[model samples]
Target: MADLGLFGPGTVTWRVHAEPILFVGGLRSLYLQALHPRAMAGVAQNSHYKNDPWGRLVRTSIYVATAVYGTTAEAQEAGRRLRALHARMRARDPFTGEVFRIDEPDLLRWVHVAEVESFITTARQAGVPLTDAEVDTYYDEQRRVAELAGLDPATVPASAAEVAAYYESMQPELRVTRDSAEALVFLTAPPVPWKLNPAVRLGLELGGPRLLYLGVASTALGLLPTWARRLYGGFGLPIEGFTAGLSARALRTALAALPSRYVQGPIYQGAMARAAAAQT
Candidate 1:
C-alpha cells in the first residue's frame, strides 16, 4: 500500500484543502500575514519575494501542497527542510533594533495561526460546506502542520474558540509597517515584466493579468476579517461578506469547471492514486 500522508483521505484537511477556493485562501493568508509588523519584517529581510513574486507564490503553494499531500517520508523531509531554512534565517526588529531568528516560537505561532485562520475562513466564505465540527477538526488537524513548521502543537490553537481567542489576544500586536506597505503595493500590482510591461501598462493586448490581479486581490482583501480590513484602510463597512461570497462562489465554480489536467496538479493526482492503492 502507498503512504497516504498525515491526514490521509479521511480527514477534513483533505476535503477542505482540495477545493479550488484555496487559491483565494493563499492570497488571503498573505494579506493577513502582512498585517503583523514583525512577520512582515521577517519576509522583508529574509525572503526574495519582492524580487521574484510569482516564484515566491509558486514555492509557497508547492510547500503547502507537499505538506498536505506528500507521502509520510516526503512530508517529513519537507518539514526538515523548512526547519533548517528557518533555523538559518534571521530578521532585524524594526522597532527594537534587535536581531531575532525567523523561527521564534511567537513568530511561528503568529504565522501559523494567520495561515490556518485565513484558510479556514476563506473556505467557509467561499462556500466549502464545512460544518462547525469539521472546522474545529480542521484546526486540530493543522496542529500537525504547525509541528512540521517547528512550532509546538500545544502552543497552537486547536479549535474554533481557541482560534478566536488567539486572534483577540493578538489584535493589539497587529499593525502595518513600512515593510508591509511595500509588500502590499507589490502584491496589489506587482511589477509587470519588462517584456510585457508596455502592453500591460497600455491596456493594449494584455488585459487578462490586470483583471486577474484586481479580481483576486480585491476578493482576498475583502475576505479578511473586519479588524484586518480596518487595518488595511477599509471601514469594514458593515461587512463585505455578501459581495465576497458571490466572488468566491463564482471563482470556485469557474475553477471547478476547468479540465482536471488544469485543476489537479501532479501532487494531487499522485496523492489520490496512492490513496486508492492503499484502499485496494
Candidate 2:
C-alpha cells in the first residue's frame, strides 16, 4: 500500500495523509461532543444574546472556515480577518458576550483533535490502509500543535482508551446526533445564518465540495510520475479543483436571499424582537 503511491512521494500529501487523519478524528470527537455543549451553555448562561441567531452564525462560520482551510497559516490569517469582521458586527459586553473565546482552550483542543480524527476516520471509511503505529505518529504530531497552543502535551490522551474516558466525562453536556458525526455538518452547514460576503460565501459553497472531490482525485493522480504531478501543480489544476469544491453558486444564491427572508423580513424581525423582549 505504501509503495502504491496512494499519496505520492515527495509531495505534501505523503507528509500529511497519515497524521492529518488522526488530527481530524480527534477534532470531531472534541467539538461534536465536548466543546459544543459548553459553548451552548456559555451562550445561555453568560450572554445577553442567549439563543441569538447571530451567535449560532458565528460558531458555524468558524467551523466551516476551519474545515475547508485546515490549520495552515493561510487559514489562520483568514480566520483572524473573519473574526475581526464579526467583532465589528455587534456591540456587547466583552467580558461575557464573547462566548466563543471563553473556553478557547477546550475549543482549540477539540478542533485540533477533530481535524486529525476527520482525516483518519475518512480514510478508514474510504478503505485506506493504515497501521496502529501510523495512528500513534499522528497523535504525536498533534501533541506538538497542542503544546504550541499552550496546552500541556501530557494532558492530551494518548490512546483511544484515554480519549474514551475523557468523552465519558463530557457526555452529560454534549448534544449528540447522527448528523453531527465527525463534525462534518459544522463544515457543511454551520448552525449560524450564512451572512458571509457574497463572494466569500459563493467561493466556499462552490469550492468546498470541489476541493473534496479533487482531493480524492489527487490521490488517484498520485499514481502518475513526478513530472506529471509537477505539471498538475504548475498548471494549478489541483488548486483550482480545491477552490471550486468549496464555493457553490447555489449556496451563494441562498445566502444572498437570506437577509430579506430571515433577517429584515417581517417574520424574522418579529421573531427577533420577541426573542429580544423575552431576554430583557
Candidate 3:
C-alpha cells in the first residue's frame, strides 16, 4: 500500500498547499510571526536568518513541503529532528534575565497558527475557490502539522473562529520590539549572501529579482491584519487591503502559468499519484 502521508490528497491541507501563491503566504506568516516579542527575540538571538536568509527560507520551505507530502515515517523523522534541534536551543530574555526553551508550547502554537492562517488568507485573497467552511477545514487539517512541530494538537487552533480568538487573546503578549524592527528591515531586503556569483548578486541588488522580491514583500506586508500593521508602525487602510488583494491575485496568476513540475515538488507529485492509485 502506498503511504499518503499525514494528509491524503483528499484533504484540504494538501489541496491548498499545492497553490503556487503559497510562497507569498509563507512570507506573510513570517511577517505575522515577528509580531511576538519573545518570538522575535528568540529568532534574533538564535537564528542565522539575517546572514543566511535565503538558506533559511529554502530549509523552511523544504520542511513544510515534507510535512505536507512526505510519508508518515518520513514526516515523523523530520519532526523529530526539528524537535531535537529546538530542544537544544535556548533564548535569554534581555529584560527579565530569564531563559526559555525555543520549543515552548506557547511559542510553537503561535508560529503554527500564524503559518496556517496566513496560508488560508493568502489563498482566499488570491481568488482561490475556497469556501468559508473549507477554510475552517484547512485549519483543522493542519493540527497534524502542529503536532509534528512539537505542539500538542489540542493547543493549536483548529478553526477559523478559534484562530481569531487565539489572536485576540494573544494581543497582550504581542508587540514590536527593537529586534522586530530590525528583522523587518532585514527580511525586506536581507544582506546578499557572499555565495552568489557576482552577476547573481547584481541581479539581487539592482535587477529583476530585487523588484520581484519588493513586490512579494509589499504584498505580504499589506496583507497583514490591521493590528499587526499597527504593531509594525504602519496603519493599514481599506485601500491597502484592496491593493493587496489585487497584487496577490496577479502574482498567483503569473506563477500559476508555470509548468506543474516547476511549481509542485516531487513529494507533492508522488503523494498525489499515490492518492490516485489508492482510489483506483
Candidate 4:
C-alpha cells in the first residue's frame, strides 16, 4: 500500500488546485443520482464481482481523482490503476454466470462523461473563460473515450445545447423532478459508497466543501414555503433559493475548512481567478 501520509499533501493540495473540478463533479453526481433509479438496479443486474462492492468504490474513486487532477496524464494514470484494481475482484452473475470486466464500456462511459463534464462545467461556473475550441477539444476527448466503450460517440453531446437536449430525453429515466440545471447539482455531488479505496476514502474526507454547500442549499430550500420549493423544484431549480441565501462569509468558511493537501489560499485563489476568467 502507498503511504497515506506521503499521498496526504498531494491529495490535499490537489483538492485546492482542483476545486472547480470538484464542484462540477459534485453536480454531475447529483444529476446521476436524481436520474438513475436503475443505478442500484444496474449494479445488481450487471455486476458479477462479488457483492458488486469494489467495482462501485473504484469507479467513484476514479471520478474524484479525475476531478481533482483534471484530464491530464496524471489523472488518467490514477484511473488506469484503479481500473486494474477493480478488474481483480471476482464473482459470477447468478443468472448468466458471466464474469464482469471492470473496463466495461457502459461503466467507463459514465465515468468519463461525468468527469469531463464536471471539469468543464465547474471551470465555467467559477468563471473560467474557455474558448469554443477548448470546449470542443474537451468534448472530442470524452467522445473518444465513449467510443472506446462501444457507446455511440454521437450520444456524447458536443455543445451546451446538445447537453440540454440529451437531458430532456433522459427526463423519464431520472428520479428527481428538477430541470437540467438543478439536476446538475445532484449529478455532481459525491457518489454513494459501494466499496472502499484510499482515493475514495480521501475523496470522502476532502468533500467538506461540497457537503457544506449542499447542506446549506438543502436547508434554504426547506425553509421556503412548501409550495415555493415545489414550484422551483418543478422548474428544475431546486437549490436556487438556498444558493441565493448563501453569505460570502459562509462560502469563505466552507472553502477554508475544506480538507486539502496544499496551502489552501494560493491554490484556491488561482482556481477562483481562473473560474472567474472563464478558463476551463
Candidate 5:
C-alpha cells in the first residue's frame, strides 16, 4: 500500500489535523474566509453553500482528511478534482465590478491561509497545546495543501510570524459584505440532515441545531483575532481566551470519550493501518 498521504504519524500536521477540536477551526475558517469580499463572492455565487451547508461541510472535511491521512495518490487526486472545479468558477466584485477567477493565485492563498491558521489556532486555544516550534512546523507543513489548491508554496506563509504579517498586509482587502452577513447566518445554524437523527425529529425541530451551533460558533468566534471580531461587532458576546479555552477543553474531552469506531472515520483508520504495516 502507498504510504500515508503527505503527513503521517509524528508530523505536526498529523497531530493537529487528527484532533476533533479542529471542527471548531473549520467553523472559524468559514467565518474568516467570508470576511474576504472576493472569497465570499466566489462562494456565494459559485458554490452551493447556502443550499447545502451540511453537504459542503462534509465535502470539505473529506478533502482535508484525505490530504492529511490518505495515500499520496488519493491526496493528489483530491487536489486535481478541486483545481478542476475551481477553474470553472468566476465571480464579479459587487463594489468594483471587477471580474476574477476563483482559482486566482491570491484568492487561493487567502482561503488557504485562513483555513490552516484557524485549524492551528483552534487547536492551541482548545487544549491541544503545541510548543512554539511545533506550531511553526504545523504552519510550514500546511504549505503542501496550499500548493494543492494551485497556490505557490513559496508564496504561502510558512511561519507564525509570516502568517501574522500576511494577515496584516491583507487586512485592507478584507471586509464584511452582504455575502459575509449571509454566510454568518447560514453557518450559525446550518440545517442538519434529518437522516442523521431519525429518532429525534421533534427535538431537532425545536432549535436543537441552533443551540448546538451557538456553542460551537461562540468558541470559534472567540478564537478570532480582535480585529476580526471587530468586523463582526454586533454578532454576539466577545469570547475571551479563558472562556474559549474552557469550551475547547470540554469539546475535546467529549469527543475523546466517544468510541474510536464512531470517531475515527475511514481516512483516519486507513492511515493507522498504513502506519502499523510500516512498523511491521
Candidate 6:
C-alpha cells in the first residue's frame, strides 16, 4: 500500500520534482499561469494571494508533494479535498462579464499544462538527462495528477507533440491582465515570514529576500517561451531561449551537487522511508 500512490519514487515526477531545481520550475509555472486572464481573475477573486502569497506558494507545493509522495489513500484524499474546495469557488471574468467556476475543465487544463510545461522545461534544460521518449513519458504520467485536479485526463495532452499543440491553441486565450501584471510584481518580491531562523530572517529583512526572488524570477523568466517573454516586456531581458536554458542547466548542476540530506525535504524523506519499508 505504501508503494501504491499515483506516483512513487520510480516515476518521472518523483525524479524531476524531488530535485530542488523544481523551485525554479514552480516559479516558472506561476509566471506562465498569470498570463491567462480568466485564471488570474479566478485566483484574484477567490484567494488571499495578495495578502498571503507565500502561504499560497507553500500550500501549492504541499499539494504537489502529497500527490507525488503520499500513499494511495492519502493521495486520493488530497485530490478530493482540492476538488471539493474548487467546486465552491466562482469568479467573474472582468473582460467578458462571464461568470465561471474555478474548476471548469478548460481553466484546469490551462493550469495543468502550464505547470507541466514549466516542470519539464526546467528539469530537462537544467540537465536532468531525460531522453525524448522519457520527456513524453513524463507528460503522459502527469495526466494522473491532472485527473486529480478534476480534469479529464483522457482529454489532456499526453505527449510532447500534443503539449505543443495545446499551447499553440491556447495562445489566443492567453494575455497579460492588470491582475497578472500586479501578481508578477508581487511574485518577484513577495514578503517572507519572520518565522525562519533568526539569522536567516534578519538576512531576509536586509535585502536577502529581494536578491533570492530576483535570482529565481530571472531563471523562471528565462524558461518562458519567446512569445510569453514578449508579453512580460522583458522582465529578465537579454535572456533569450538559449541563455535561459543555459542558466537552468547551471542552476540544476549546482543544486544537484548538494548533499541529499540537506536538500531533500520531508516529503521526499517520507517517500524514501515508505519505499524502504515496503521493500522489507
Window of ten residues with lowest summed lDDT in model 5: 233-242
Q: Give the per-residue lDDT digits (tens) of candidate 2, residues 1-280.
A: 1121112223223344422222223333333432344443433344443235456545544443232323344334555654454344322222344425433556455555544454544444334455766655555555644544445788776554555566566544445333233233333243323666887767766777546634433332332222323333435355543442233222233434654544233322333354445455
| Candidate 3 displacement at residue 178 in angstroms | 1.4
What TM-score would each prediction reach against the true structure? 0.95, 0.38, 0.96, 0.45, 0.94, 0.92
| Predicted structure 1, TM vs. truth | 0.95
lDDT (C-alpha, whole model) for all candidates: 0.87, 0.42, 0.89, 0.45, 0.87, 0.86
Location of the lowest summed lDDT over 10 successive residues in candidate 2 = 1-10
lDDT for predicted candidate 2 compared with the true structure: 0.42
Best by lDDT: 3
Query: How well is each residue in 157-257 modelled by candidate 5, as lDDT tens digits?
Result: 99999999999999988888999988888877676566766657557756666677689888888888878878887443444756877898899899899
Best by TM-score: 3
Model 6 spans > 4 angstroms off: 194-209, 235-239
User: For every candidate structure, what is the RMSD over all alpha carbons to the true structure, in angstroms?
Assistant: 1.8, 19.2, 1.2, 10.9, 2.1, 2.3
Best of the two (1, 6) by lDDT: 1
Clashing pairs in 5: none
- Model 2: CA > 4 A from native: 1-35, 40-104, 176-280
Instruction: List, residue by residue over 138-239, the lDDT tens digit for candidate 1.
Output: 999999999999988999999999999999999999898988888777787776655655756668335786778788888888888889989988889745
* Shift of residue 3 alpha carbon in model 3, Å: 0.4
Runs in model 1 deviating more than 4 A are: 193-206
Q: Is candidate 2 or candidate 6 better by TM-score?
A: 6
* Deviation from native of the Cα of residue 218 in model 4, angstroms: 3.9
Model 3 stretches astray by more than 4 angstroms: none
Error of 6 at 279 (Å): 2.9
Compute the lDDT of residue 190 as modeled in candidate 6: 76
